[model samples]
Target: MDPRESLIPPETLPDLLAPGLRLISVGLNPSPASVAAQVYFAHPRNRFWPMLNASGLIDETLSPSPDSMRRLFEAHRIGFTDLVKRSTPGVAQLRAADYRAGASALRMRLHGLAPRAIWFQGRTPWSQYLRYTSGEAPAAVWGLQSQTLDGVPVWVTPNPSPANAAFPLDVLTAQLASLANWLARRP
Candidate 1:
């Protein structure tokens, strides 16, 4: 049986790699805008770039251009991926089964990459990932901090998406700041 046929392999996904991708952000799926741009989290309203900037994770703001972010992500040794290779407009559009399946696949990739951490944004995805994984993995800040999952750290950060208005800009910045601090020590 071909395992590749059952799910979207990492190759088919819009993945980024640097000198050695130390951190890989695992998203539930690509946004429609991201798919169109072939960049992760490319939506104009998405707060991802701004959040990273405020957090100090990125020294400067990534221009709202998808192409630019790609270059930046690569330069930083940070990668982006989605549980589902396809795109959907909103989280509500996804189903429980999707999270379960995505979680299962993610564990496999987490092992393959051997990244220092697998950061998941949005609590929904994190909770779903935890549930499907059958137990706890390291929990990281906003999802931040150093913790281990099968020996690799797992960090959970606030979803920089506009949909998550609960985390105001300043608060989000603080959370990301913690993440930045952790990352700083890693290298």
Candidate 2:
């Protein structure tokens, strides 16, 4: 077994969040690998770190680790969380109840943090969040959405999970770049 697995807690991955965050990236849920490593998007093929570095959002390249993520939160004011906290081998293990609870929890966190904008890693988390909170999941596009989470702007990007092969790294990078450009214009 990997040494990182010894660090895993029963609650799985912990949220990397803080007040006054400029942006928050929300994933669908934590994978077992991420939980073991105690890092979001820890999987080698996930493309999250690579896409983030290539998007020009941050000046430095970040490897998948707790320290790198902490630097992102502290230095860049970019936080990380998930629609669901549970770590599972696959999305098929998740249930509607999970989304419901997670959405409520996420709403509370966002309200408390009041980040300038939210960067959803995929449409599922955004749509599920909307569905659970509003009783309807509106059709969404790939970039910025017209909707806001209680006045916090929302931006959606392709899921960086390697399982989501429909989108390549370049596509994900471009989408993140768009979000970066939008953030640059924010007050």
Candidate 3:
């Protein structure tokens, strides 16, 4: 397939996920570029990978390719998933119904998988999770939350999308480092 094609591929990126992980990073949804490339956080401008490395969560930096995902899960005990499974050109393209259904499904999955902690990449997914599950849309704080998901701790951070310029890279990196520190202190 020509890489320039804007068509959403039949296949989207698969979740690099497993049960009993130390950390699970959740995204809002797949970007069209990520879908077309069949990789998570694959957009060239996306800083998820860079910030992940800077945080020192993993032993080394990882490429956002499917091939590198195994190392993340197997060695680092980190996994990835998204609140919504569908790919869109932008988050605005996602509907409320999509968030509702996705949040419900994610709740069930997290209950089953039982990761130690969940780090939501942005506020939307976490907010939708609270709204759908509890009927209250509370404002999100970008750090460890008071709530727990099936006994798993929840963390939030600014979205690393190139579109989210409000949080500087240094701030984002610091948030991730905080998360890393929290994980280290856990038994």
Highest TM-score against the true fold, candidate: 2
Candidate 1 C-alpha error for residue 112, in Å = 2.7
**Each model's TM-score?**
0.80, 0.93, 0.91
Clashes of each: 4, 0, 0
lDDT value, residue 153 of candidate 1: 71
Look at candidate 3 and give me any clashing residue pairs: none
What C-alpha lDDT, on a 0 to 100 scale, does residue 109 get in candidate 1?
A: 61
| Candidate 2: pairs in clash | none
lDDT of 3 at 70: 77
lDDT of 3 by residue, 65-150 (tens): 87677778888898888899988878889898999998998787777788889999999999998898889888999899988888
What does each candidate score in C-alpha RMSD? 5.4, 3.3, 3.7
- Runs of candidate 2 with Cα error greater than 4 angstroms are 1-8
Per-residue CA lDDT of candidate 1, range 33-132, in tens?
7766666777888877777777777766676566666666766767777765556788888887787788787666666566666677766677777777
Note the Cα lDDT for every prediction shown: 0.70, 0.90, 0.86
Model 3 global lDDT (CA atoms, 0 to 1): 0.86
The sequence of per-residue lDDT tens digits that candidate 2 reaches over residues 1-187 is: 9999966565677787887788999999999889878889998889999999999899899999989988998999999999999888778999999999999999887786788889999999999999999998998789889999878889999999988999989999999999999888988
